[model samples]
Target: MSNELYIEKNGAIATIVINRPQKKNAFTLAMFKELGALLDELETDKNVKVLVVRGVDETAFSAGADISEFLEVRFSAEKAKKYNDFALESIEKLYRFSKPTIALIQGLAIGGGLELASSCDFRFAAENSKLGITAANIGIVYNLTSTKRLYNLIGLSKTKELLYTAKLISANEGKEIGLIDYVYSSEEIEEKCFEFAKQIIQKSSVAISGMKKVIQSVVDGENEESEAISEIILASYCSDDYKEGIQAFMEKRKPNF
Candidate 1:
């Protein structure tokens, strides 16, 4: 409902922009609710084939939680949990989103910002971007889900090194360490993201959606050969999208999936 988290749709692509440039797009408690609501809507929106989460400008993806609110809103453990619940809702929604999701990082994706990017299926960073998990610097422990996501990206040793040092790494270094997927020049990052999205949008949405779940299951340490995985595979094979894919290959033309 608030403009802090707003959606802009172009055809089947939906971009959720964090609008708090004055604070480098740092998220507030209310903004998290708005983001969660948007994610909920997009999750069930069949028309949305791809989703991109980005900051309002090239200044930053997000600087993490607004600590300014801590004194008034999260001073106690009870209040802290409630504050965390809002963030967890939004982050988990993004992490478990069925469709393809991308975090287009520009500059200063630190602390919770890095965690947010880790939740996406892909992270595309601008060449000038800086990324790190800064909770340790402030004497706070990262949440389990966020820790798991970060661990999945950079592994145990690097995760330790990152949390211990709380140092910012360049976009290229982030990509090398598996924290980010791709990096482009600052001026070209947004355009490159759309180009990447176009490649995904041309595929079979049903197949992609199914695979995303299966892959996430594996990432979560679920058995890939389990009955649930089989069911998902069977459903995809039985889908019209599968037939279209086969037919298009035989016909030697592009598939309109």
Candidate 2:
């Protein structure tokens, strides 16, 4: 009912915060709708080259969906399906977002929270954080699309082990299993995540976006159309960024790619 989702802009980066700290940032129906709309706005905002998602407090990224609302709104089979569809739309929007995305995990990323992080291009968590996919414990089933996203990042075996057991794994274990890209001390997580994003922004956005599309196509088992690949290559070659990159190299200067 409140402004559960907050957006903050920092130059080329945008941070989306799940703001209901008292509930461990548990997402409500309104929060899901707000997230979808925010993501839609970001998609057309070319100045935003990177996006970071995080919880307001350091205790939890999101405990899960708002359980209190479930009884009243998602109790029936038909309503549950509709609810799932609405939540899934927001998740999918993040999954296919054009620019690079990072999950700045400060604490527990559980259930739907983990699914949300998995949708991002990269995840960086604090050393003391824990993550798990716990649909089994709640007597609900994870949708096929969410399962595919998790499987693609961590492999089917690891995905199954996490889901079937419904156990929380440490940040270290998450990194070992490829669930998280990097882990940092709680004291340094925010700075570290922004540093990582800055490094990524120094690279060619055109190339980064092209690779994202190719990776998504491969994950979706779509045919790699030669024409599409050719277009990407040609567009990158012709962009002003490409010219600046080459001239900067010849001049021994850092490229503003």
Candidate 3:
């Protein structure tokens, strides 16, 4: 991975930090490729039970794609399509990552930054953070997958309002509109994020991962009891984690997942 992006593992929780703070953590195409690769490795790493994505500093989560490379990577239809495809692959991976994922927005989360956060299972932002998508301002249409994610999240009208205006909303407003799951002061955001992650890590990974897929399937318009969904439910019932959980519950002790 580039020095601008790296992963830190702490027991069951893994964090991918975007470190180009000098550019407000704006991601270059190289960085996006590195991010996509990292997610691939972490996807099957059993040691990781939760994943958190954040900028290295509180200044900004990311200013979106680096405009400096636009002339080189997005100046033509062919080039832009390739560039967007690379970035979206990573975003889609994060969206479908089996583990619980969280995006911690300490500051600005604009354009692609907001899409990154929206892809995660939870979006926690600092009270002072700002977030929005800016495709309208640049005269470019937002891609369908990211647009659909936002539509599923904030609903059609709110998604339309956000995409059309290109206005960054405050973290509180984001939370109020269901764009943000939690918000806190800069001093507390990271600490609170881990606290929540620890809580998640304490749960049954089998159940959590299975439910994550089931939820995503539902969001993607799957029926309540698709064969795949039933398989997930059935597999969970036969998991060692389920057996241990029941035993611990009867024995009045915390179950080790």
Worst 10 residues of 2 by lDDT: 221-230
lDDT of each: 0.90, 0.89, 0.93
Model 1 misplacement above 4 A: none
**Which residue ranges in model 2 land beyond 4 Å of their true spot?**
none
Q: RMSD of model 1, in Å? A: 1.2
Clashing pairs in 1: none
**125-215 in candidate 3: lDDT tens per residue?**
9999999998888889999999998988899999999998999899999999899999999999999999999999999999999989888
TM-score of candidate 3 to 2 decimals: 0.98
TM-score of each: 0.97, 0.95, 0.98
User: On a 0 to 100 scale, what is the lDDT of residue 177 in model 3?
Assistant: 88
Measured over all alpha carbons after superposition, the RMSD of each candidate to the real structure, in angstroms, is 1.2, 1.5, 1.0
Candidate 3: misplaced stretches above 4 Å? none
Q: Taking the candidates one at a time, how many backbone clashes does each contain?
A: 0, 0, 0
| Candidate 2 global TM-score | 0.95
Q: Write the per-residue lDDT of candidate 1 for residues 130-237, one digit (tens) a residue.
A: 999888777778888888788888899999988989999999999999998999999899999999998999999988988898898888788647887788889988
Better of 2 and 3 by lDDT: 3
Per-residue alpha-carbon lDDT of model 2 for 2-50, expressed as tens digits?
5788788998899998998899888887788889999999889988889
